[model samples]
Target chain A: MSTTPAFKRLPRAVREQQMLDAAVRVFSRRGFHAASMDEIADDAGISKPMVYAYLGAKEEVFIACLHREGTRLMEAIAAVVDPDLPPDEQLWRGLRAFFGFVGAHRDGWAVLYRQARGEQPFAGQLAQMRTRMVEVVAGMLGRATAAEGREVPATELDVMAYALVGATESLADWLADHPEADPERTATRMMNVAWLGAAELLRGNTWHPSG
Target chain B: MSTTPAFKRLPRAVREQQMLDAAVRVFSRRGFHAASMDEIADDAGISKPMVYAYLGAKEEVFIACLHREGTRLMEAIAAVVDPDLPPDEQLWRGLRAFFGFVGAHRDGWAVLYRQARGEQPFAGQLAQMRTRMVEVVAGMLGRATAAEGREVPATELDVMAYALVGATESLADWLADHPEADPERTATRMMNVAWLGAAELLRGNTWHPSG
Candidate 1:
């Protein structure tokens, strides 16, 4: 009747993260459909009931992973991005931090954030986060535009935000593929495109088709 | 029984396309997994055996739809994009056609192109097409930069191509959402970002982290 060391009670936060880590690994491997709760529970080394007790059902578990990873990523970028700094610096820090996060948490970024885009169930959650990111970027662009005494049209500005976010996500996929690539250098390249393009637009530069 | 009129004998190409159109609609509605052979066959007014005879199985049917939609999209863009033109014109036309295809075939874009990215079975197919696109853009960048008598590092050039492609795909999603958004006009706005940013890079203008 000695106390069992392997079955020691874990705190809620630690257990939840454990479940999520296992969940991400499983989901990344098997996708959302083939991945089973039993597998996740086994992978976490916790019973199925403990998984249910900490996180809800499978969908809830997936959402928990998305929320946790997405928040960690957003916060990682947010922490370094100071609004008072020049917009280029803000963007540089943000992109660097973003690539850094994805580089470090490849599984979370791949399974939770990147893979979630294709599933309808998670689209709302993903869109909410994307909309927030877009708004932040639009605000940055607006501030920069005002500094330059020019403006981008509203609808156009929205699409620009989408383009910028999409570019980062795309590059995130690239970074995930090339583990040897430097996140800082990737961020620098992205800044070259995004900041320069955005600066041109905020300065009211436009392109036209002769047709 | 005198006759059975349920299965009409159409040309192979037309029938294949009909099956694909049905498959895209069904896949978009039900997703790649939940979508069944019975449902898709019924939707196309063909029997289950004919579906198998023509399209093989569920995975094959999904791949066929992806191939069809992806090819059509590529052709549309290629028709408008002339490599002989300036890089900006080439990119502008290419983007306009891409957005147009996505706008017209939102269902295909979502399910076949976008959704397929998450599922492992289809990732290879999707990646093949995307890699081709990245290669084309990279070649264009090389040409554009050489025109400016500057050279972007090989890895950075690869990533710049990825960033540009990702930006376009992100805006394609945006175009899919806003049905009223004009594809050509959106292309102009995108050009303003992509071309300007790219042009700046070709001219050796780059953003740096000052901190």
Candidate 2:
């Protein structure tokens, strides 16, 4: 008798990834509430039991998608930005990386930014990613200001970072909606709006309320 | 027998509003998917049939809530901002009014900004409001630039306004999460980020990527 197994079993890692890709696609199409395990399993070409075994319940599966995609986006930006570069250059790179990631994974972007932001448990995942991104952006903002021989109050810097990141994400969301928009050009447009404005602040031109 | 009717029938306008208030409360607490017509009707002190009679369906009820609150927010900002004022002052007043509206109706803010940005019918509602707000912001951005003796490309202004509005919405989201935060102070923080950055862009501090 031949001793070889009849079918080759995929590794657990490969199976998990396949499950997540299917989940993100289905969730993007069906939304979190309408998406079903059967559809995701079928999309993965696996049994529902296999999906549950690898990714736990429906909620866990959605969260797994959020974690994976969120990590990828953060890493992509982090990989490109250099501390020694000028702030505009660093921001340009970071935005290029971000829009590139979103352009590459439009479905994942929809699931993470569009879908998971409503429900409580899933919203937390998106919020945590946002918090981390805000901190990273804040650090970059602070470092750049210090290099320019200026200081933005820490409290104010925090809000500024949040606003910059928020604005970038909004443009990213816009890119996600328009399938043909060029990420590089879009990033430049964002730089004009964000960094140009920020440069003025760096140059100590701030708005004051009149009495 | 007296000609007066024993029971008062709430006019369609009043009844429709009551149903919306109930739906907003339920949707805010239970989320869009989990909220039930029965519960919404119960909360409004009306019967299920009556809710349907006034609002049409769950979907329509939700849209009605969005329409009402979105209109209210726009009106509040419109009431405060004067076109005759300089761009900075107009933006300041707009931001202040926006934060105040959000603070006063945190639940409505969640339903309008956070919860409704996902899914189809609901997302469409939010997107429409965002489009309106973007156009207004774009007009303001255009006016400010023109006042400085220059004209920005229409396409660039569109994206620029989008980013600025998105940042303000993010701060509004932050204010939604924080119950203890003061709306006026929050508005000031946002103005510092948005207006200062905008002021620089107006001064022609554009970022150029080196070839």
Candidate 3:
């Protein structure tokens, strides 16, 4: 038998991922403050010193986890959306992907996202990720409107995108909290609210207040 | 001249308001962690011990500010909403009041609300306020659907309310960040997005995914 542990035989990249997976579980279960590095190392089947050497301190480990999860979420959405598809289809697909990710990773959504939302440094990172999502949504809206020969103002598109992103996020939070809810149905409900309003807007139908 | 200071003559209720105003300003300028009781006292023109006597510690002072601001926001929305009015009209009035409040108190929104969102104790308070808002919104939605002879499920109404509240909150955050933005105009934009979709839903029009 080899003297080295089996984990030692793995490549550095693979080891790093294993550490991140363990870290995510710990962070999810214990939150940012209560979570300990020792637990993370134990969960990863690696020693504490090796965990620190590989991913730095606890905060650094958390940031790495956040970055990985965020990247995975973005990649999940990006993989499904195609510019060539109709706007409604793109939105439906994007939303379905988003809710699916949240549903599957409820713990990650609760701890990484909800916890980071109110905290300082993590909030900034989360904000950066949100800005990217808003930009992507705005681009999709812009393309959708252009296809319909309407030139909506960038600010308007941005605001609408903000609303959409915010609404979707709120639903994701709701989904994370509800263990019995179906992600696809939640996505469908979102489409009913989002796509309907967006379609009405694209059709130049405005809701004017009646006195 | 009287031996007592001029501030001493003020009623307890009046004095408390003064302290809270100062606390809100300090908390806004210097987030939750960075804000100090000393600065709050100085700004309010009250003594540090007096400030502590009135509002307790820094955390308590922050909570007091949050409670006051949240109460004011809820009152603003409640005052504008009338059951006799059409659902769309009621929604418009509520949204206008909400944006108006946010516009008038951008600092409070940034500090009291945003800062509390990620932090622990304050986050719980904020969630309570959000739940109240969601309830109010769901009630309005239920009334609107009932008037139209539709009996929507409570869970569905709650979900829709969550999406609306989330979207509105997102836009309010945007408005707070954009000093040049007009609150009324922002409210109108929100109306366009919200009312339009809600109107469609009321009319029994739903967006279906096309293969």
Model 1: clashing residue pairs? none
Candidate 2 local Cα displacement, residue B141, angstroms: 2.3
lDDT tens readout by residue for model 3, B1-211: 4465767777877999999999999999988889998899999998999999888999999999999999999999999899899888999999999999999999989767878987778888998999898898899889888889899899888888989999998999889999899998898889888779988887788888887
- Which parts of model 3 are misplaced by more than 4 Å? A1-10, B1-10
- What is the alpha-carbon lDDT of model 1 when measured against the actual structure? 0.84
In model 1, state the lDDT of residue B170: 84
Evaluate model 3: give its TM-score.
0.94
TM-score for each prediction?
Answer: 0.90, 0.85, 0.94
TM-score of 2: 0.85
In Å, residue A89's CA in model 3 sits off its true spot by: 0.4
List, residue by residue over B1-211, the lDDT tens digit for candidate 2.
Answer: 3343546444656777878888989998888778999999999999999898778788888888888999999999999999889998899899999999999998779655677886666777888889899999999989989988998888778888889988988888878878888999888877777777677678777677984
Arranged by TM-score, best first? 3, 1, 2
What DockQ would candidate 2 receive versus the native complex?
0.58
With candidate 3 superimposed using the best TM-score fit, by how many Å does residue A173's alpha carbon deviate from the native?
Answer: 0.7
RMSD in angstroms, candidate 3?
Answer: 3.9
